[model samples]
Target: MKCEDFLFLNNQVCVIVGAANPRSIGYATAELFAHYGAQIAILDVAVTDTTQAALRTAMSAKVGREVDLLCIPCNIVDPVACDRAMQMVVEHFGQIDSLINCAGIVRSEGMLDIPSQDLALMLDVNLKGTFHTCQSALAFFTKQQKGTIVNLASVAAQRGGGLVGGAHYAASKGGVVSLTKSIAREFGPQGIRANVICPSMTETGMLDGNVTEEQFNQVVAGIPLRRAGKPLDIANACLFLASDLAAYITGHTLDVNGGGHIH
Candidate 1:
């Protein structure tokens, strides 16, 4: 089977953290990679029968005949669990070719009104979690002499979006942008590429708690596209970064905000 030139990394294995549902960017990313002949491994904190994760993994594999996928349960806050998640991916796929950090948490309340626990959770999932996975991936990439990492940032990190209780979320995602750039600098010499994707108000379960129907519509109205983004919008990007097409891309945040960030 011939692979698309844009999919030069075909058959490469990618570990995606946080694929929870049809609405998850992680799931969309998994589907795209699988379609391009890349193997996939998923990790998530979703509360569901193990069958769900397995089903998603299988579905991702089914997207492309003969593609492979594996799913492992994990919570990024736990260091051992984080390492084990990577190990599972490597053990199943033989090597990890790429990593997409999609597991994140957001809490909505005014800054002062936000609970400290909520803030901690956001940091743990967004900032510390990225670090946990990146550190694990780094050792492997450094030893292999090449690798790719795509981190999910948020437009809030840049413009402060100023959402209710969004300060903590913004801080966490902001760290992602900075951490991504720094990681790129440290790993570039080793033939590793690291990048960030900042998406704005995408339709997903992640925002279910914060966005009401009216608020959602209001935000969409502000977008020049006059539409909210779908999970696929951000997932498609993981494909490009994982492929050789992005060999020259690193230390940058690609904003997929439907022109919301044009300002």
Candidate 2:
């Protein structure tokens, strides 16, 4: 199939977890999906007054057309909240065709310095939060016998964090990778596909929060592409995984690290 044939997501209801900020991968994925004609449901910790407005303006500009958008307030650490949020998406959009888990935290504290509370926070938000959201969305996918899940892991998980995040962060994301594969294995028989995207150094708020320019530049030197990843780079991959182009693919990990981490 041609590229254009594989790109459109018209009328599909897609739920993007953690689309609260403009620079986040979640928002970027939503924007790209909207551009491809998907009806978007955005869930975040709290949908601010500016949330809908910002999404409308940005997505409209992105696709050069008005987008169908829904905003929901959710805290994914709570399984009930995750379920309730998706329930609202189902009620509004009728059926959910895709779920993209982009909600996570980036921590750069030293391994020995990571406090118990901080470690718990990282695990709860990055690992358990993903678990809750996936579990909540699974019922719908299983009932429909057709669904796609695109989860966000990190290169830190693969390489054990010489880049930005700490050891604890890497561990949590490692868990995400394993969990994604488990979902794929368990649900593949039911026509549900699950995959993980592991990006190395992306130009997102998560990267900014953890790395300085010098650190980023140093890492960039080692990458074959000689540049940091853009949000669109990762968003485009998410688009493909959610589309029928990836129908035969599941439990796979796609790295968008500008060739930073080679298998």
Candidate 3:
């Protein structure tokens, strides 16, 4: 495919989960998908999510919109909530061709200090949330015999996690990577593809609550690029994976960490 022709996601539906804010990877992915002509269904966990949904709508509108958009308030940790969110996407868009799992949370503490509840929170939001979503979406995909799923893993998933995150975070993300591969293996024959993106130290609000400048510099230095990854960097890769150009690809993990870890 030509570089220009690579913009292949046209008139598709991509349900982007975890659009917590404007700079979030979820929002970036939604924008990229919209730019390539995919309609968006943004699912978020908070009531305050409407603002972000509109912001993304406005951005896409500026680029010229030819389809309807829907924003759903949902918490994927609950199976009922996940069902409602997916049902809304189908009702609004007619069918769900893609699902991007970007909804996740984190709590930082040393291994010794990590409490059981925080550990469970990480697993609940990261791993369990993903499973709930994929479980619901898989049936629809299987029925259609065609669908795509892109999951958000992390650099922590590769290096056993960092100071800003912990064992639970890594374990959850590691489960995501493994689960993505399993989905691909089982469903590729059913015409469904699943993949994961692993990025590090993004400027998302997930870090807004606590990341210090000194800490940021140290994280950047560890990366060969000497810079933090951006949501757009991750979004663009997801945009491609959700397109026809990546039709033959599945069960693969893409790293958007700016050369931080070669694996």
Candidate 4:
């Protein structure tokens, strides 16, 4: 009936990956989820005592309250670490209602310029890493018989390698799209929902060395919205897909690209 009633996540435990950076989509999602009354657990390879403290301080300042937060050190490429991280979240929070995977890496080199190791690393983190985290969370979700998953992909996956990423990055994200769809179909009957969000040219640290000022302005001009996407823009989509507001929506690729890549 009310706005909050539709999007509220009161007491829900949500695990968000790649949230250590304050300016990242993951952080914005954490802030918004906290605003909606969800308990947050962050997993990042860069998580440390200092980063965790800084994230807590930043989130508290943004949310205007002492947010319920947990930070775990996890490199999603390692399946063992992913499993351990999920177990820790459950041990601390008692349950995991949702898992939002925002962790990934991007490279801007041309296909031929991308070396063997670079391509391998790209797929390992972007594709295989996402798979690891999803499998880890689904282990618990399958047992609980109900859960939701929101995966952050890139518009590069849909429109090819014209954005900030290279062909390898686009290919990896395309894999992510296919992976989410398969999970949605396989696990939907078990009451688990999986969806992907493809955001275009978001204002996050990921664009720092990837896009030049001139290129950014040119890309924004082509976008119907005539502006770059903010982290909150993508985070809002994550909230909807991760909340009961999208109870019946699964295996869907919701584009938050400001009409940049209209099919």
Whose lDDT is greatest here?
4
Ten residues in sequence with the least summed lDDT for candidate 3? 47-56
Ranking by lDDT: 4, 2, 3, 1
Model 1: runs farther than 4 Å from truth? 1-6, 47-49, 52-66, 162-165
State each candidate's clash count: 2, 0, 0, 0
lDDT of 2 by residue, 47-100 (tens): 776888887788888888888789888999999999999999999989999999
Query: Candidate 4 at residue 149, lDDT?
Result: 95
Q: TM-score, each model?
A: 0.93, 0.96, 0.93, 0.97
Q: Where in model 3 is the C-alpha error above 4 Å? A: 1-6, 47-53
Q: What is the lDDT of residue 108 in candidate 2?
A: 87
Q: Which candidate, 2 or 3, would have the higher lDDT against the true structure?
A: 2
Clash number for candidate 4: 0
Task: Answer with 1 or 3, whichever has the higher lDDT.
Answer: 3
What is candidate 1's lDDT per residue for 151-201, written digit by digit as tens?
998999999843423889899999999999999999999999999999988
- On residues 1-263, what C-alpha lDDT tens digit does candidate 4 reach at each position? 77767447988999999999999999999999998889999999999999999999988898888997999999999999999999999999999999999998999999889999999999999999999999999999999999999998889899887668999999999999999999999999999999999999999999998899999999999999999999999999999999988999999999998899999
Per-residue lDDT of model 3, residues 1-263, tens digit only:
77546557777899889875677899888877888878888888863655855665576576575446677888889988998889878887889999999989877777888889898888989999999999888878998999999999998899898646777888899999999999999999999999999988888888976578889988898889889988889898998787877899999999898897886
